[model samples]
Target: MIRSIIHDEMFLSVPSEKAGKEHLQTVQDLRDTLHSVRERCAGMAANMIGVNKNIIAVTMPFGEMVMINPVIIRKAEPYETEEGCLSLKGQRKTTRYRKITVRWQNENMEVMKADFSGFTAQVIQHEIDHCAGIVI
Candidate 1:
C-alpha cells in the first residue's frame, strides 16, 4: 500500500532499526511507494510512510534501488544545500557530505558497500537522517 507521508512529532521521533527478514514486505512497500512518486521525489525513507524501519529507496543516475540498514561508513567535505522532504512542508538548509561510503544490505540480505558522491551521496544521507528521526 502507498502510505501517506507523516509529519507528527511522534512519527519523526521513532527510531528505525536494521531491516531484517521480517521487514521484506515493508521494504517492498517503500520501494513501491518510491516508484509511485518518482516523478516528483528523488528518494524516500521508511519513516516517511509511518514505517519506522531502516530502509530507503534512492533513485541514482543509473537506476532506482533500495538500501536496507544503510549506514555511512565514511564521509568527507561537508557542504550546505537546500533539501525538501515529502513528509515536511518545505525545504530547509541542511549540511551534507560531499562524498560518502555507505554500507547496507540488499534485498537478499547480503551486505554491500559502495562509495557515492555528488547528488547520490546527498540523497542517501538525507534518507538515512530520516531513519534516524532527524526531520530536516
Candidate 2:
C-alpha cells in the first residue's frame, strides 16, 4: 500500500544551516516510501507542473534528482513568481532562477548533473534551496 507524505512538516521551519541535511532526509524518506509519498506530496495527478503544490511532480523519473548535496553551477536572471508549498496553506511570492544548472549526489553517492529551465528549473531550484537550508 502506498501512502502520501506529510507535506505540512516540510514548510514548518526556516531553512537554517541544516536545511540541506533536512531536505536530503526528506527526499530519502520519500524515495524509501515513494509510492505513497509521491501520491501524498502530489496534489494533482498528471497535472502540468506549476506553483500549485509545494511538491514538484516530475514527469520523468529518468534523471529525476534526489539532491543530497546540490550546488548551482550557473544561474540566470532573477524572476518573481507565485509559488505554493504543501507545507504552506496558500500561495506566496518567491524569487527563483530563471535558469539553473546543478550537480548533486544521488542515493548511490554518484555525482549527477542536470540543466533546467522555465518551471522545471524553478522547481529544482526551490527543492534544492530547501536542501540547502534557504527559504524565500
Off by over 4 Å in 2: 1-28, 32-64
Q: What's the residue-level lDDT of 32 in candidate 2?
A: 43
List model 2 lDDT by residue over 39-87, tens digit each: 4342221101111112222323453334555577999989888777544
Deviating ranges (above 4 Å) for candidate 1: none
Q: What would the TM-score be for candidate 2 when compared with the true structure?
A: 0.61
Q: What local lDDT does model 1 show for residue 50?
A: 80
Q: Residue pairs in steric clash, candidate 2? A: 3-36, 19-133, 20-131, 54-85
Over the full model, what C-alpha lDDT does candidate 1 score relative to the true structure?
Answer: 0.88
Cα-based lDDT for every prediction? 0.88, 0.49
Model 2 residue 100 distance off true place after TM-score fit, in angstroms: 0.2
